[model samples]
Target chain A: MTSTTVTSDVPALVFVDDLAEGFGAPARPFHGASPFHRADPASTPIDVLDLGITRGDGVFETAGVNHGHPQAIDAHLARMARSAALLDLPAPRIEVWRRAVQEAIEAWGSDGHGAAKLIYTRGIEGTGVPTGWVYVWAEEPEGPIERRDGITVVLLDRGYRSDVAKTSPWLLQGAKTLSYALNQATLREAQRRGADDAVYTSTDGFLLEGPHASLILRFGDEFITPGTDQGILKGTTQGDAFDWLEGQGYGVGARQVRVEEFAAADAAWLVSSVRCAVPITRVDDREMAIDRQVTDGLNAFLLERDC
Target chain B: MTSTTVTSDVPALVFVDDLAEGFGAPARPFHGASPFHRADPASTPIDVLDLGITRGDGVFETAGVNHGHPQAIDAHLARMARSAALLDLPAPRIEVWRRAVQEAIEAWGSDGHGAAKLIYTRGIEGTGVPTGWVYVWAEEPEGPIERRDGITVVLLDRGYRSDVAKTSPWLLQGAKTLSYALNQATLREAQRRGADDAVYTSTDGFLLEGPHASLILRFGDEFITPGTDQGILKGTTQGDAFDWLEGQGYGVGARQVRVEEFAAADAAWLVSSVRCAVPITRVDDREMAIDRQVTDGLNAFLLERDC
Candidate 1:
């Protein structure tokens, strides 16, 4: 993937050596695909005190860009609204967000495939206002290599019991907040252990979620996913997929997943808007069956569906 | 405290309204109480995409400034360094931070009293560099009065067992990270429930730390804090207070605390660098004992000693 992370050079104050340049230097990132365009990315500044940056007090969603369009825009926005409410943030302006997404989609055209991220932060604290923006970038072509060749997975404890979400509202367990340090750390931890990804098991020992996606298990024809009541962000892509699958007369439902089930499942995969679907062929030393039919069906459905 | 959230006019581009203002704003947050003196708070700019703002991918520390001097500059810096390490961020330059503290303290010049917050974020997401800065502001004169009167607290579930720290490193349980949405939300949850603050209980039922402070229990002359293995951030102020209490020949130690024990203790307080010490006179529906002597001793030690 030509990650915006590496592809677009957003001008920054590199404090290590060029703090002065950060404050006063040249044209950096070539602002890509904008509804609210920063013709000069270098000058699009962020406040030093933005609590979003200072404290990660924010929420975000990513819409997949495939087949020359921003896929699942409505689903992403709806999820963002839910994430906002979970954080007690003001209800987002759906009209405004819709306009931005439309602009983003139009700006990108059908030139390439990537992702568009929508960010909404509680603004600088105390203002009772929020800061919101969109960033769209093309992923490197090799980003989806894993989807074609399944991934190896490991389970890591998410540190909360499976049922902690109902009673502990403050954990914001269902919100997709900007405070992603732990999520990123878990991926690194999995990488360190020679795995491609980590599936979090709640402290109570129930399998929970992947850091950035939802877990799906297939026991023959039944399509099962762990319930959202377990404190994980509801997966928009999974929801979209299940809706389409159920309409086709396939079994789709939510159930508590046990960690050991992955070791024995006939088929499994991680699903998200961006990655679409990454089949789990191996779960911690146990090789599982990968029904190419299930994986292929979901990926094709994910791409063909409209938000 | 006269929160800048409520006091200072920290300028912002209310994107929900003037998205244009966000793109064309002049010098964002009026840099308040400058150490590296921006001269015009209105001109100090933060990049729009700083990961700190984008991801809350950072850590922070607040030094209590009293009688015109920033307290525990060294101790706070040391803790920041550790917080940085926990997040896998680079080790902060202690001397650079020390100079900032010195400059901040020197500039404030015995004015009123409040807190000086030191922030270090992993810069913008794709950029390997990081952003670091300090903000100093005065507290409302009445803010500290709560310390004298004690606070009403409600116990909230922190959603982890006391020992989850050792088993779940990615949780960043002990790190004083900027991902404070949950922390802030817990305090709001407490306030909405008719309480002044919240004390977190580990999922397994052990008493942990407060959202922004450490849990301190007094059993007669015993000065006790919950063990750090419970995944609570080690409080810098609590450490300073414990050192003083021990030097004065009082028994100070770490122990596992239970919820019911609060009702039985001679005194209980939440200690932190900024809040100093807040005695908890009541918890939930249970009224707890608050020993004036113990509360007074700790407060005096807090003000008299430097971190």
Candidate 2:
């Protein structure tokens, strides 16, 4: 497949066929009509549309690129596996996934200018198994931000359906499924209420993560995030960063973070594979300054790991 | 369209080419891509699908039939309109829906069936409006139940997505979108726990309603149901029963019902378009006797209506 760039005011629409062609590789096969089946089958080849992403039934993961290679590839794969299992979905073959990422990066050439996303989903049709429609996409890099200038966030009381199980319920929290209509709605609501990004809180007032991202706070020199048991996904980037932080003699831990505690953190940021770590300047209407120690420590950690 | 009835060992399957052909009169039509549309567009045309009852995305009204004719036809039409409005869908043309129902019943001959269903939904594909698929299917003699023995109900903590709105959120609640996968899952889970049906409670512990049905209770000769404020679709059957009961001098009211209140009720049953009132024998693990008041009141109500 050929790749072309369109210079329109609208966001680039990357065709799915081209994406699959660039990322597709031979993988282990399984047979079942359900989207949750672990094995690929000889039935109709699946595409992105077939995966409930259009309907928002699947989950996804992305990672920082180092020298045009995804960092902590195994961690992302393992997380995807866990998410798939939780949703009773068939897991994609790791080797196939690796090859797809490699090809996707190769398609982007040696620029090392963008992040890579690995999206896995229940293929088209409600058969309940993973279709072999996995692919990677390259996007413009997020600009570096002043760590001292934290980002602002909004707290929305719109409880997520998967808020009870942290990550066990495959319906929402586990995989980056396509059931994102509500997430988008929440974001729109947050925007309407004047906020940069929204942190979803359950009806009981427990702070979840930001939409399409994870939350991290720096207390003293320690890096802290809400535990996965607190109804949030076990973020791959957060996990890697925590391990690296602890190894460097910095305090890093996971614990339950109440909504009030998050609102009053010393320093906070939203973490994701694409944006790495973006500091939070304000939450709802409350504001905070970025922690220099935390930012420097995380940047040094990312650079040292070549992420 | 031809009408055919196939009696399987399990349940009877009735097929109709046109829903309008069955409902005696065509209901009013609305405009737009979904049945939830508020405006009527000149470009839109009414359409119907054969997979009406199977998928359950269509709006239906079950009213007592007198001499094979429905009562309070306007109320059902108005509810269907509200359902269509919520889904941003179009309603069927009133004349078309009326004619369809009339033709179907005449075809059925002298079947002294009391219950009639007016099903309106996005019909078969390729009709105008691309999304404006609408149809009606009528059924006589709703499902049979052994009311002498109460039915078992399983309590599910899984929250309903739209609980704050009085009308069904058509995109999510009303207008009968074809997303019944969760409903099926809930039923399977209930059956797995050895229950006849399931009652979905809100995340806040308020009793919502049953899957594909409404809640009714007999509390000291007063018929009580959850108010629309509790986030249930204004049930037509429940509304009719309430009006009829109040007119008959029985204290009937709609109010918010807590989960504990539902559990503690002396007698309860679920009312819907198809199932008039099925007694609840067990809730979760707690069992209750089938209160004679519910049966007596319901039978008297039905008999007084000349059903």
Candidate 3:
């Protein structure tokens, strides 16, 4: 069953063929073949033995799609490769995945804002093969409202020290993996604490990233995000935002952020792919002033990102 | 795509209908109907949006099967419920799952040792309904050999304190969730280090469990496993083994173990469902003597378990 015509906001799924046919692997037997093809969303292409679901043994990237272009496509793909390497999975064929993303976006008939979630997994157990898929769908309309109204966030303990990725690489920190049960639990915890979102603080009192977004704080005129050395994912959206902030004559950098520094910050926002840049109006019991001008500009820049 | 016949050692899949129909939920429209049914292993059934695959937002239990009987099923199911509660997933219907396991085992035509893995997920994204499946398959023929000959292990840092479960419940430390990329990575790391398996130690230097198994160290005549307070899963296999040990008039208990005490122990074993109890011949660079009599007796009892 195939449906090329984009209808409602339902997700369009595409499966990648030979997801990790890198250097040592032989070329596909069939020549002139596309690396990916759209599959029926209703069908379950995933096997019961697929480690992707069975073990959550996979890496994924959700890139914001503006019109027909995937935002930070290179960065997202690079991060995916890095995550795969961290998990010791095979290196993903970037060009093939890049083409797959574009094909998925085009097949979804992207006319406005959407998200393309690229998934690469260790595939079926004992197969020595990998699985890849790109699912594209229209973004929810509430993103704009969330950006405008702002969100409340709470600082929660991440239960790991800042140097965890360096000390324990098997812990799989800094990797956007399918093993996100803890991340989802963290989000639910934030909601349970009467907050819309949460910023993770390391066990030793260092500020980290959010469950699904990167934390960016503005102190005076300087913008800063937690350094990537602290076992946090390299934020693609925050990187792009920093570039825009620099262009606007604002000092932007990355460094180790203390948990207590949240009070001294002029403003804060959680930046990521689908949600873009969302201003944090409240941090725990503290209600901070929101920079409406900067927030608006950042959102505009993020939503319209072509690269 | 229906196959009721068990052809080879391939897996037999069964889907549970209304997986989480516990209290405060609607009953099945048809009464006196089976809560689960056999599924075609070759057919695609899982949706791409399943949180099980996307976020690894789910709980699972693997019970060893012998002569069509699921070993430690009750314990496995109970642990699954505990894992679900830890992740805030809906409470699973135990009776339905028990029946599903039986049906799956029957469908698989289990004649010897096998494994029945039960997976209950938070379901497709945005869908309140949960997803569940029972997969039964024949076990590899190497467990007896490994149990008799033994395996080597390396100690890896778990990157968390022993009391993490109580301090940060959102970490989902003790839960048997599908987010096992780290567990898989730990195994790979051990393999890379020229070891057969990996045992985890807390950041504060407390001996923990293995990536997929429980650690049991024999000191003199007393056997000790890591206390459950250390953010580790309560080992169902170890629990049963303890019962057998008690029958043999041996002291078995759980407590906080120090990593440095490994050298002082008489023997150690990494025990799990599928692998049963495999003696640890070496830890890191230290070679330990294997208890062949206890190992063989334990495997025999475990393989012949009726419950």
Candidate 4:
């Protein structure tokens, strides 16, 4: 009954007051005030009838915070905007969100690495107003500093064809919504099968992405990720890594990749905002080789990158 | 923002203390007290990091509360347990939940009608303790007394094959988890297409249920709903209606219904706990006949059902 033990790492929270006022929407009457204000995460600022939780009608982004810098936040914000559009909730005020994230990070005052999560919801039911918040908490990375080695993953069927996004946009396939129960279920399924993570595949035998990350496979010098057209998220971390990879003269592309190509790949990694580039050592029953040099490079670039 | 206008229907909430203690789980150390306690929904009892909102890692059921009676609550609880098992959450204490619902309804003090929504979440992230709450408020039945006419529906591709539940359990298809953003999106798409609601169809041409309701088709004296094997929630209202229909000498069944069969059916109704049985007047551009007699009978049974 008492929550003394569960009260560890309370996040610094900020509620965005002008979340849905973007995209030529009329400004609020009180225009001089700050767009967002910090709130207590433990105080539970959200309404019980908020569509975000009740109907899972919301989108979110989590960016890694290094020292005072929120890493790859612009891309995260852009993706959040895309997700919001996909859900048809409202246009997110990118400037407001950026300031909210900074405020939350500043409130947290963590010089170490942590995760800054931005949550934008469709707001309370029957009310058109949207709710938005950003919470930052310090994340003490367990074990080694770099997360770039030996992650075994199982390929699970996502139960949709690769072209589901194109055929059925209402399915919200490409949108990074808060409705991630199935994604969590996939990871649990992976754990049950004695694997560390899961890589989702289309029913038609095409590699998609991980439950919460983007999958990038290496075929000789060419690095290919399952295209965003395949109803998967456009990974922010993956994008940053691709930029670094391109600069290093490695071919990078996002296209329809077959599951059979996993076996042909020299190495693979599941990339995400918080976790960065985690090397895939095993896929299903097959043992995949780890490209340690490239993995190290990607992780280093991701950890040190300012933007 | 001072939330004054949006604070009209504050539901009476009861938090179940012994939520996940069912299925042979050991009782908590403090056992000599009430299993649940009333809380203010406006206070936001949920943790910001609760998986229910964060990952949509939860299951919920909303039963129609007619006066003091919670309609088909046992069925809803059973379904919630099934959903929790599917999501690997600990089993819910049904008796405790029943009492919590009763407490919430009693606290609401509404004699007319309302919705009693039971929410069982996986609790705050990394905390094993599950969170359970039931909220009840006066529904005040908007407009007419009966909700059994003039509903137009559009058939949208659910983007999964009919046998997805059998082939891919990790998809969490049949389980009524809290991840309903896509379902909300589907409804939006239906509205955009000038329809009131949507009925999902399998990629392989099988009839699935609606986003938030069960589709029941009537062909003369026979009533048929999609089988549970199609990865859809088994409708509690539909089941009660089936029992009532059987007693009325009508044939009722749950089977693998095809999309083509919808056209052949004489009448169709989308049934849910809160809405009862609403007759579908149209499917896409095609107009369908509404069986007023049968619809009225079903609604009467659903609205007046005890226990």
Candidate 5:
């Protein structure tokens, strides 16, 4: 492993030889974060800066790193395959991506924390290859625990392209794509309105997912999040936790969660690869009880799985 | 005016001293076309590239240039003003823009063509000044005819963000901005579906406008198009044509236009600054009768006004 010093406060970038030619490296430790690099490196790296990515014209996946190993790598890869097929981009080679992840983990050394991102772009202009950009970043567990307490979410009645392919077309559903300007804008607007995050509602008032994030699952003992049909990005960690809960005899299902029903839920939690599980203490300023069972179950699952 | 040798097939680009700068020696002959320059003079001398245009972060107006003069310039300017306000961008000085147009006309010399473009952008990174880029490209006249034709348009359910603004958002709409990838994609899709241009519908089925254009008087003589309330870019030419028609004792108003109604209109035309009242001859292989009065009225109105 080689270390290079970068003087600018911007993210450090590097070039990887294994990801084929022309792929730019991520700013050292912030894998898969938006605005990957503030400046374009001089090397003209191919894998990272392709138009497919610069235009948000591709799909991706981020898997939870457990003991420096990506968990459920197959599941994340399967989702990416589905997303790539939907977007009409070429699917990535699962084996090659897995190898790249392993190599990245080995380079990061043992004490590395956080998730590993498997970024598959449409590759170079004419090769028709599903170019991949993989990197591992340390995940900081600093999400507000009050988030698990409950969240005050406002319904924005505008700005979302498709409500059907929420998780598949993550380009809008916080799929970790480069085209996140609007999602960022939506969040800014929500912040301006004194809300934690904004849930996009259809023009006709159908409840959609949150911007650059997913909706909270809150309904009795039956935890429910908006289905893939609802246009919410299928969060990796969330999916894993739900599966684990279901194995433990809990009801987990994807359903058409309505705005009113979401507001009236007994407890709610926002899930993501990085945030893991955070409770929403309020819904549009309405307070709700934080069910200790849900949090405990999630924490135990994370611990057992060592994510 | 000093004539320069034109060599490149892509046309020469000329830079101006300022947004308000003029270009013709004896400027009387050339009046009412915005001045422009190439972004990289040494690379492409004769290629005129508008800096404000390349970003698609600007607003623009296309007006009919009749007998070397811009028609309906005030109405176009007014619409651009509204668009700029929507994006919180500064509006260009009307008089200065008008003079720049005149300078551009003189620089291009008489070409027996008519078409003026007014482009205003957020300007370069940091000059603490709103730099504007303007240019007018002449479209050779197709023989004057009294009868009008109808255009065949395809209905695309792609959602656009600034459907309410009269001018599209620079980022998504790509109207004033030179980012025309999506526009080109939509057009290609329309052509594939066997249509002349595309009319984008909202995800909820509300009819918006066309790609890089607007719809006008599709069904009956109602003179309807997607209103600002429908998230459609406010069409200046459509508005002006309707206002003029109403002044001439014709009933005209903007209303929600459906695909079925558009297909069944007595006479339908796509309106824009460059195309100006282009009659629709066929729509998705469906034929329709051309409305002569509508075309005659539009042409007369164009001849009477000075942009």
Candidate 6:
């Protein structure tokens, strides 16, 4: 439902209203020694000319934090690096990214759930350098609720074939780039349709992914997600969950799924780091049977995961 | 080949280095009568938390100003409004935009050529309001040179079909939103391949558009551009020029264009508001025949006419 404000203890994000009113969260925020930024993320100074904002010419990673400990930090960092390389961006400084993460987590405190985001942008107009920073925000209370209640979804075409990732480097198919207008628009479209979520299909009528989450299907005991060849982002949370599930003796894998097969699957999920996984019980507003036992087992296993 | 800098008289866009040195354009930019910002375009303080920067959840219009006269002000505003409506964003207040434009143009002065951009975002996260501003940048020195020399281009797959916009409203295919990461990436890929620009073709090999500009093809005396049905942005400059061309007794129209026809056409031009009309002398590393006379005629007609 929402991505902001997960727990009461997570530090405030300092809204413009908060700043104007001089209320909520301490005025001072934690700062890393990185020259890219000195002020806390809430007040981080980014030149308007920076390609990151102006052209949305940047990459980013969002990781979930529980009790101030970030989940899947390595996966997020690795993906961000891969995205940078794809964009021909300079390699990200791992040590600096680590410091920024540590500072943000400590500054926000360990009391509750939070969301930490790392942004890397090609720097100012003429300079080919980069600007990188970390920002932490409180995860909204709705995250847990969305996880429990499950969701209904509508199908939308992602406007691409399944194999473009192999041919077109310019599309940035799997990168977690900051140019998220379409994803946001898709989610809003779902809301407007009175559906809780959306699943994107490729031009060839194959299930691709959710706008913000990965799609996972269970056929009997086998768990499958669409392969990277489908031009979908690799899901860090889904990968982690699969590892834990395999240890518990579940068959796990990735492959392409046609829209017809998706409709026939025993169970379906739109999985992500923050939401963990939400069962999708409807496709295009048509209600369907759901294997609740599978949903419960996977959700339980994911909650037990510490990293 | 750049989209920035339309005029010589526009204010200097402050670079990070400029901010550090306290030099160049007067640091105090124009504060719109709106409370969103009080600083000028060069120094406007936007909260890092602003969704405009973080998510690229916004719409923008770029208009050229020659002799302090903003070209196509009405068209740009109307297009911005259309884009906002398509995104489910509130209709932009035209009066407010007009004032912001006046303030920016006056501050920059009427000298040579400049670029004015209006950006509108869905406010500071929670307020359900908006953050809008006008920014002016001096036209780059090479814009005219590129126009005169014409440009070479390569073709890339846009990963969409021609009808995605009509069938999937969620894709936001034709709207000119601020989420331009893919467009910028495509341009970089073009530059890497020794080309001045890129033309995007649909997955089915239909001619779509140039990354930021529109594509116009000439077959003898008939001039045609891919229609709106092709999920392409309706080019303001292209439309205006076509109107003038029709009056001048030239055949002008819109329809689906396959890559084959595009390659076989007598000549082609990548048309946009800022670049006007630039000849495409190559596609996919292969040299194309240049009807320099047609290129010259279109560019001259575009340059002589202004809003």
- The candidate maximizing DockQ is 4
Q: Estimated TM-score per prediction?
A: 0.84, 0.59, 0.95, 0.95, 0.60, 0.86
Error of 3 at A124 (Å): 0.4
For candidate 1, the TM-score is 0.84
Q: How would the candidate models be sorted by DockQ, starting from the highest? A: 4, 3, 6, 1, 5, 2
lDDT of 1 by residue, A1-307 (tens): 0011222343211110001111111211222222233222343334445567667888888888775566877778888888888888777776556666555555555455677777777765566556566656667655588777888888888988887779888899989998888887788788988999989998667888899999988876788899999999788888987887787788999989888676666788899988888999777778876678767877878866655
Docking class of 3: medium
Best by lDDT: 3
Q: Give the higher-TM-score candidate: 4 or 6.
A: 4
Native-referenced TM-scores of chain A, all candidate models? 0.85, 0.76, 0.94, 0.93, 0.75, 0.85
lDDT of 3: 0.86
Error of 5 at A297 (Å): 5.7
Residue range B184-289, candidate 4, lDDT tens digits: 9999999999999999999999999999999999988999999999899999998999999999999989898889988899999898988889899999989998
Clashes (backbone N, CA, C under 3 Å), per candidate, total 19, 82, 1, 0, 51, 16
Candidate 5 residue B202 C-alpha distance from true site, Å: 6.0
Error of 2 at B41 (Å): 24
The total number of steric clashes, by the backbone 3 Å criterion, in model 2 comes to: 82
lDDT for each residue of candidate 4 in A1-307, tens digit (9 for 90 to 100): 1222243245698777777764222333333367767766656556777888888889999999987889999999999999999999778989989998999999998788888989998877887778788888877655234375569999999999999999999999999999999999999999999999999999899999999899999999999999998899999999999999999999999999988889999999999878889889889899988898998888888987888
> All models: lDDT?
0.71, 0.53, 0.86, 0.85, 0.53, 0.71
Interface RMSD of each: 10.8, 16.0, 6.9, 3.8, 14.9, 11.1
**Candidate 6: Cα lDDT at A245:** 68
DockQ of each: 0.29, 0.06, 0.49, 0.55, 0.06, 0.31
Runs in model 5 lying further than 4 Å from the true structure: A1-81, A90-150, A158-182, A201-207, A247-249, A296-307, B1-151, B156-193, B201-206, B218-223, B236-252, B258-260, B272-278, B289-307
Candidate 4, CAPRI quality class derived from DockQ? medium
lDDT of 6 by residue, A152-234 (tens): 89888888888888888799988888788899899999888889889988888899999889988888778889897777888
Report the lDDT of model 1 for residue B198: 93
